[model samples]
Target: MVPVTTTQIHSRPSLTIIGGGPGGYEAAMVAAKLGAAVTIVESKGMGGSAVLTDVVPSKTLIATADSMRRASGASGLGVELGDEPARADMRVANRRLLALASEQSNDIRRGLERSGVRIVIGQGRLVGPTTVEAVTESGTEIIESENVLIATGASPRELPTAVPDGERIFNWTQVYSLTEVPEHMIVVGSGVTGAEFASAYNQLGAKVSLVSSRDRVLPGEDPDAAVVLEEAFVEDGVNLVSKTRAESVERTADGVRVQLTGGRILEGSHCLVAVGGIPNTAGLGLEEAGVKLKDSGHIAVDGVSRTSVPGVYAAGDCTGVFALASVAAMQGRVAVAHLLGDAVKPFQPHLVTSNIFTSPEIATVGVTEEQVASGKYQADILKLDLSTNPRAKMQNVTRGFVKIFARKGSGTVIGGVVVAPRASELIYSLALAVSQRLHVDDLANTYTVYPSISGSISEAARRLHVHL
Candidate 1:
């Protein structure tokens, strides 16, 4: 492998990015391209959680599930069906996931190199506001830079009472390591991660029991979207336990047993914990560097991604903005632009779109009813169900809807939600509209193909006039 040469290194404003995930690596790329000598320190492989264990692998698995669902729907479209059910090979599917993750990681590393960024495989800690100490396999090296970016990302949140053993009980990051599929999988925490895995495993023929601490599957998502997923999970024979919290999990000889807060018990062949994540901020010298941390232990940053300390900034989940990869990348770019004296827009948390990778994925951008109810926004909401949509009926997808929230007087699209197949893709248009401060009139005026799922989106926008 060709190493970065000393001659190529410059004495200009130097940037050192710690963690080398989407945020770190992307910041390194931006800083390098902007004539800043950049160095990235990475403990794990490139692409971070988005590639190795979280986004890429989970989405790829969802893709396989999608294909299976489509094939099942083929019979409804008058296609022939076989008496035997289709089979999914977990080993083959996992092999493909790993291969894709590796390829993407390599591509990210190569891109950083081509952009004139130096990458060192090590765990980086902040020695000061502008100095990073990297512990590599060879030894430790302290690098001084003009600016530092922390993108250490996060790890799966585990409960002390019910920890993941990585065998019978697994965390979200460890679930992908499975070669053989479990016969019965109990998913604790019915949030985004839990819903996605439950949906995938249910589709893959696993007996799934989804445990939720809230009244619905996706408590934090759009209300209509949550309802749709709850119905879908029920139709697929997924046992939905609402308002139930797993107090503890223990590995049994035959499988696993989970004790609930209310003294209820759930037994399954395996348990996957998807409660949440904790930022990878410990022992990073953050406190010593004078960076302020939030109550939840996430680094506090301004709109420009700058921490309390000058010359030090943070992005991605470490900042706890939206916890979305897209938002993380944008924040990283925003940090670079601001530091490099380039024209930059302040990071807007409201405009970031996020998706939960369930069967009929749920994607939302901007505000929600809960936000409005809680006085976060006083916007009016318009909802359109997919049951009346031609494409949804044709596809045999009976559940899901499109909902949009806009300022009552201005009609500016403050927020929107989509809960249908490819909802992740559909939420982008709304994200753009919200980011650009577009109004309902713009969405209503836009043309959508007849008999398309997106037509419902337009209809939802059109209905906004009634409230106005």
Candidate 2:
């Protein structure tokens, strides 16, 4: 395809979106629908990290891995034992996941094309508030627009010495490249992603070791929710190396060795570095454009996704607002709405909901225990274990619970955590309540389905006033 000449540039309210991830692409579609001539510049595939690396591939792998776990344990529920416990053929699963990832990417590409948005497959750098330079396979092209959306997402952060080679040692994103499952996987970091991979592999018949710098797993999550997840991991036979800091990881001929700060060494067939992701903001002219980045290297944006620089906006992982796909999508929408002077809700970081895709997944919204401790709110908490729920009993699920946090005086539900099977689906009610600041009495008054796990959520809210 011949490159369009600079002379062919049309006059319109042009919107150039950098980084074609969920945030960027979604923003481009919205902008196009709003009659803005849109262009999306991307370094990688259209779906960016979520589709090409993170969300799509991980969830696809999880589906197959979860099925194997269920089949393997079916005998324990009085079902006749299969000839042998079903095993996960990672080679086959990897092929399936890659195909699904490709399909998702294509879907995004087609959707954008059909919406009259131009896609430039290359790196985009800001030349000015309304000018973006894209270096593509064909050649360099400058997109002069009335507005620019910086949606450049984040990349998996690597430890100084534990660089991934896409083989024995790999980051969370590169782990999907493996065609074979590791005999033993040592997951470094106890964060949400780390816990999810550790749990998935352990359930898929891989001996797993989780190294945590903190005293317990998922240290940053709700304390009670973390406790329940730790118990579930232990029950799944995951080797939890808690309070042991990872000094470095090196790959040897036989396996990978993780050296701890206290001089302990843990060996495993593969090492997964899930420490975290760093925003892809550097080398993008953000500094030159006068956009402020936070200490953690994330673009600083206010309530409406407007960055420190005027006429420039950023959203998604670039803004470092919770690092969730849903939040990223929301930020992108708000950024476009604010830019177009349309009716837009102010970005509310506190009300953004997130979920950890682990077994008996952890879903949460609003404030946390640390916030309450820091005097953010005078609140009381109530927790109800799933063991008391009839549906949980029917499903043979015992290791989970729901906890709700509410204002001490007003009884307004401010935050909540659900640690049960399909917790992502069950946490929406809590998310709505937190977003709207619904009172605990409002939840307690509503009726959940009979024999539903979500009953624990309402029951927990009912306990707030009684215990406080």
Candidate 3:
């Protein structure tokens, strides 16, 4: 963060933020730094759903699962990993993830206090445009500020027939409570969250069956990238059920029974419903405060995080914007910056990068292949297979690729998709290229370590240079 001189106002601008997730706590820090007297109203300790339940915990579990995957695959690489499933301990992994979540929440709270932001623990809501009411178990407190930001995050949507019991039937958040890996895990929903857990648990020595309503997994992601990930999932022994929706999930005498479309039955030790997330917008008094909400119940906000009513703003999953934690943090920063009259940049969807945490991760940013194919934008695209890379051969990596899209005439990098191990890490250069509008030649000329998988990124760019 760049240091900026405090605003020379007679009285410091006062900002009150509701919720303490990345969108709320990060904004409080920024608002305080910008010379605003900041206060945060939170009910879920600190770090909101992202840290306490969703992103942090799930990623931690995936890390353990990844370690297990590497250890199990070592024998093929001439490294004998004796006694399979020794390190794949679910109880330990669950305990560690919960500890990490709690610690992260505390850290965020401490950081907010250190930044001179006041923390109010309660369920906060908008009473009027600039007035917030926080209700706690003991009492209620009303707060008034020049600017109010609603950053309450979201929660996993429960199926009408399959409510999570936090036992055999679990939601994404409830899975962190597992004492043992499921003997056979039936995951419903083939989106990022579903695919991630399915991959992670399967890596952790569980039989995973992924159910998708679409014809293939990751319906919203790039089709080519989805193909690669689906292939990897199948090779890893994941049972892929496509074009079928779960009619119901019921616990059986010994395990669980999932009734799919057309009367199909899947029996598994556990069931996970990763259907989707609904915004935590109800009961927030948004409508009474003249804030417009979308039909989907998400708070509607403009680019600068301004809601329907002036002096009221909303960010994060609540706003139904890009759902990544990074995007939420940026929205919060933008909200505070714009509110404090500081230099600000509106949210940029085109520059947003997202990754699916699968065995072979899929990361993408900027213009999509669909948009280009539909003549939404005239751009040249290039895809270089990771199998052709030197590092991939050395690592015995067989799948995934680096795909880049550039302007048709100038070869300026506009978009990209990467499917490989740690594709999230390999995608930053492409994101930077798109953000900075760097030409293909610029990326192609950049230095990449020899025998690196990331070389495919620059190689893809180099290939695209010829398209123009």
lDDT, each prediction? 0.87, 0.87, 0.90
Model 3 Cα lDDT, one tens digit per residue, 394-431 = 88788999999998988889999999889999999999
| Most TM-score-accurate candidate | 3
Per-model TM-score, in order, reads 0.95, 0.95, 0.96
The deviation in Å at residue 128 for candidate 2 is 1.9
Lowest summed lDDT over 10 consecutive residues: which window, candidate 2? 1-10
Q: After superposing candidate 3 on the true structure, give the runs of residues whose Cα lies further than 4 Å from its correct spot.
A: 1-10, 83-87
* Residue 253 displacement (Å), model 3: 1.2
Tens digit per residue, CA lDDT, model 1, 1-468: 323222123469888899778898888888989999998988878888778888888888878778778877788889876887777788888889878988999999999999999889988898777888888777777888888999989989989977888878999877766777689999999888899999999888789999999888877777778878888898889999889799999999999999998899999999999999999899999999899999999999999999999989899998888777887888899999999999999997777788888888888888878889998778888888899999999888887888999897788899998988899888888988898898888999999999899999889888886452
The lowest-lDDT stretch of 10 consecutive residues in candidate 3 is 1-10
Q: What is the model-wide C-alpha lDDT for candidate 2? A: 0.87
Query: Could you give candidate 2's per-residue lDDT for residues 214-286 as a string of tens digits?
Result: 8999888888888888888888899999898788999899899999987999999999999989999889998
For candidate 3, report its TM-score: 0.96
Best-matching candidate per lDDT: 3
